[model samples]
Target chain A: MDLSALGSCVSQVSCVVTQTTSGLISGMLLFLVSCGLTLIFGVLGVVNFAHGSLYMLGAFFAYTVYVPTHSFALAILAGAVGTGLFGIVFERFFISRVYGSDVLMQLLVCYAFVLILDDVVKMVWGASYLSMGMPEAFMVPPLFIAGGVVPPFYLFLIGISALFGLALWLLMARTRFGKVVRAAAQNGDMVAALGIRTPYVFAAVFALGSVMAGAAGALAAPVRSLTAGMGFSVLIESFIVTVIGGMGSIVGALVASILLGLIQSFGAIGFPLFTDGLMFTFMAVVLIVKPTGLFGQRVR
Target chain B: MQAKGTIRHGVSRRAALKGAGALTLASGIGGFPHIAKAAGKVIRVGMNTILSGRVALVGTSSSNAARLVIDKFNAEGGAGGRTIELVVRDSKGRPDEAARVVRDLMDVEGCEIILDSEASSGAFAVHEVMRTRGVLCIHTNSETSQLTADPKMHIPTVFRSARQGIQDAVGGGQYAAAIAKKKKLTRWMTCSPDYVYGRDNTAQFMEYAKIFDPAIRLVEGAWPKLFQPDYTPVITKILQEKPQALYSALWGGDLSAFIDQGNLYGLFHNIDTFAVNLGDYSVLKAVKSLPKGLHSGSRYNRIVPHSAANEAFYTAYTKRFPGQWPTNWSWQNATGAAFMCDALKKTGGKTDGKLLAAAIAGRTIKSPFGVKGTITMRAEDHTIIDYAVAYGITEPVDPYLTDIQMADWGAILEHEAEWKKKKGYA
Candidate 1:
């Protein structure tokens, strides 16, 4: 190739790289959120529509903690632990009653919680948008990746997401609890026959899933404006990610999250007007072509 | 239908029941009971707007302003001793819901006038309802140009008290054009919501900007979905394009996210950003650090009008609702209520829609937000005129906007006429 053409080609490649990196930044955050939805749906056998609200609560809880302590670590901890406890309580009282009921009944319960949670948020936060500025640790300058600039916090998210993924794998594969959880997923009756307290297992799984969502929200707090119903958009995106990744699959969520991130980044660039529908379109195609997601187990 | 034998207080039960039934039938036959109750006593003014969801503040401010005006009017012996009773309903930011709620206010609640405080999305729907209902409506929150500028969409009973996109575009365009000329900035990109108001506002701003300065070119336009939480990708594209300047119509949480994210990416540091909707208290208070040197046209800044009446009203609003500043909707709604009151007063408390419309047509009234201490309800089109539209550089401190520059109404109207002509709008 001629020198000028080669220079242009290199620039184009660099542009692609930059956009991809940007996609990965959001991709990592989505994975953090969607994995929890997948986990909760898998083990709980109930679609947790209130996962988004949990995420919102996580961010607000973090905000509550952060305002007083101003420690990012404490805030994140408060987000995770607070949401985890909230999930336990909700599951123990409301969700547990409708565990084996109709999906619509469960959905109604969740919808009720959604409305109540939104009201509660308004009551506490006063219905105004809030900002918990990036933590001191994350207050670094933008990093250049392949001739494009990006926030360093985004890179931090990617690293943290990777670490979380690893820890999740270890917990699910290396531990006896993971074995029992997997057994419960395969056949809860058999796990019960094997003398396992299936209820405790379900509660633990819900709490764990909620912790994931809380961490994601805490991570996302800096990147987003904390509004009354801010969890909604995250919920929609997480739903999309969960569906595409095959609900209940950690590996699938990670892969699908990145794919979605890239699609959104590229789709926004190419088809700005249809960008809103792009993710739904992707999900529709996936549901049509393969109801069982990439990493999900095929039903008999 | 009454029993033959019954007694209470010197009357049989049958007789009392018969008497009650006759009275009810007579009242029903003579006139609706509601009308009888309303006659010379109360003028129920209906209002419908988003009262729930993300933009509830719009409804809150609009409702509060109307309350402020209505309380004063009622206290002053409202329009010939008929008190103005506001019957407000929440639309939940849904267009169809807004229409339904407005209808309920009119039909179910016996409201005569509609004070539509919906955003553009729901306002248009509410507009259609009022067109058929034929009740005088003063749109208090919508800023979409076609809501007023398009003669095709214009209804006799529907008038706008809020600023229109064309008005702000001309003003903001001229203001930004001057800045661009001084700085010799040519490349421009827009980051606006991907909706009617956003697209129309951005297009108008760009058109007027080009009219004012032919040297500028639109490099790119980023249209994010309304209430879009993440502005990362859009911000990335803008940064990559490296436009010399930018404009955005994104407001509320969307605008806050854009500003905060843009700051992180150094998007504003390099680009001369002019987000017109950035002047709201929501955005001003929400942003992490109010970035310096950002230029925005006034939406609702207390210091812009520089009038005693405006300051007094601001004081009144703050006093009424402490710690919460009145938004742009507050002044517009207050203006709308005042206009309705003035018309009612002119007609000596008549609720006749046509008469009230005639009273307000081309009438200039004292306003807290007016440039010259008065705002005119333009006769040719039922929109506003001579409001204190301006632009200024932003600061990080109180009076967050500095060096406030008011836009010329003459220029705005002149350009607005040209724009209408271009759009084939009467």
Candidate 2:
């Protein structure tokens, strides 16, 4: 190619690389939302339709707590912990009875939960958009990495998601409690016969899922505006990510999130009209070919 | 099951007998009672709009605007000294709710006229009922081009205050497209809120642009879901495509969100030129920052220098609602309300639905936009010829507002006759 054309090509390639980085950041947020959803679906064997509501609550919590406290750290703490507590109440009071019910019956119950949570949100926040931001202290100069200028906070997100994934891996692989939980997931009666409190473990897992979802929402508030309908979009995206990442796989979520994020960012630059369609296309390809997803295991 | 069925049958039979006896008594007493009740009774006006969700801003503002006019009319004594009682219902911006709410308003309240069915769907639903009932329906903000113009779209007894979309596009488009060309951005992309109004506006603008300059290619278009809070993905995509100009038809919460997010990401700063087709003061106010030369337009700018009507309306509106500057749309809505009131006054408070509709469609009404001139509702299609201007955000002010510099206004309305000649049965 001529020198000017070569220069143009180089510029285009650099732009593509920048867009890819953005996609990764987008994917990380998706992963955070999906990870909890997949976990709840995996262990509970019931789709929590109110999962999006929990995500929205997480964001609102972050906004109210963090904005007043002026501390990002406190916001995450309050959001995650608060959502976790709320999740426990939900499980004990509402979800506990539907343990081994038909999918249709579980759906009806969860749909009711969705309605209740939506109403609760309306009552709490009223019907208006709320704008929020991260603490000023968390603001860092844009990080220049991978030929793109990304918010330093996004780098922090990458590190946090990875570290959280590692910590989760260690807990699941190395702890006795983790083993019992796994056994319960495999055979609840067997674990119960072994004198393990399976129901309590189930409750803990649900709470854990809630905390994860809330943390994701808290982290997301800074990047996106807070709205009542925000949860619905995340809910659908999270479902897609979960199904694509293998319905029950944590590592798969991390990988799939990054993959989807990259696709979104880069794809957006190249095809503004088609960017939303890209992630769905990826999931369709994965499902059509592997059915169980890239990281999903077959049911016994 | 047998016992319950038998009990229900017995009760139903007893109820039927009672109903029959009551019917006999109602028939015996009907005509005289009806005549007595109908005399000097208040004529109900059913007003429905989406009073919730993202478009609540529009709904609330419209309700208040209509109420302001209604209050003024009542003070002068209502139509024919028959009090025009307005019963408002929230449609929730959904057609089903609109149909349901409108039906309730009509059946339960005994409303004679339907005023300002806010959204396109709600307006259409109420128009259907009004057409069948021969009730007068006046649309304020619904500028869905075909609702009045398209013969196929059956909405009888419905007349629009807002100009047809085709006229609006011609008025806004010609000026905007010329500015885009002058700014060295011949190629354009449209990012409209994905709905009927957005789609029609964008389509009409594009059609105008194509007619204006055949060379102008629509490079890329994006229609994100209406009232979507985030546009980073779509905005980023559009920026990457490097279109010369962006025409946005997003309004209300969507526009607010777009401005907030777009300003943060320097979306406009990166682009050579951007235009919000209906970007009014409300959306512009919410933005913490605006691109220095960003082109935007509103139906009316409060800052329009040297206008007697505007000055008077501005003074009145500000005096009433302190600290909150009224938007261009607020003025337009007020104008609509005023027109309806004026029409009723001309007829000496007569509640004749046909006369009210005719007076509005054919008569010139005073508004803040200009000197009182006839709306000149074309007999071909019921769409009115109204005023619209395009401007650019020139500077920012402390009241969370920006000064808009007027651009070409004449060229925009040059082909009004052609647009009027274009016929449809909407």
DockQ of 2: 0.28
Q: Estimate each model's TM-score.
A: 0.92, 0.84
Candidate 1, residue A283: Cα displacement in angstroms equals: 4.0
Pick out the ten consecutive residues of candidate 1 chain A with the lowest summed lDDT. A1-10
Residue A102 of model 1, lDDT score: 82
How big is the positional error of residue B256 in model 2, measured in Å on the Cα after superposition?
3.8
Deviation in angstroms for A166 in model 2? 4.0
Model 2 lDDT tens row, B274-342? 455435555555443444666666554565533676677667666765644565446556666666677
True contacts kept of 2: 0.19
- Every candidate's DockQ is 0.54, 0.28
The sequence of per-residue lDDT tens digits that candidate 2 reaches over residues A182-224 is 7777888899998888889889888988888888888777655
Question: For model 1, what is the alpha-carbon lDDT of residue B304?
Answer: 76
Best by TM-score: 1
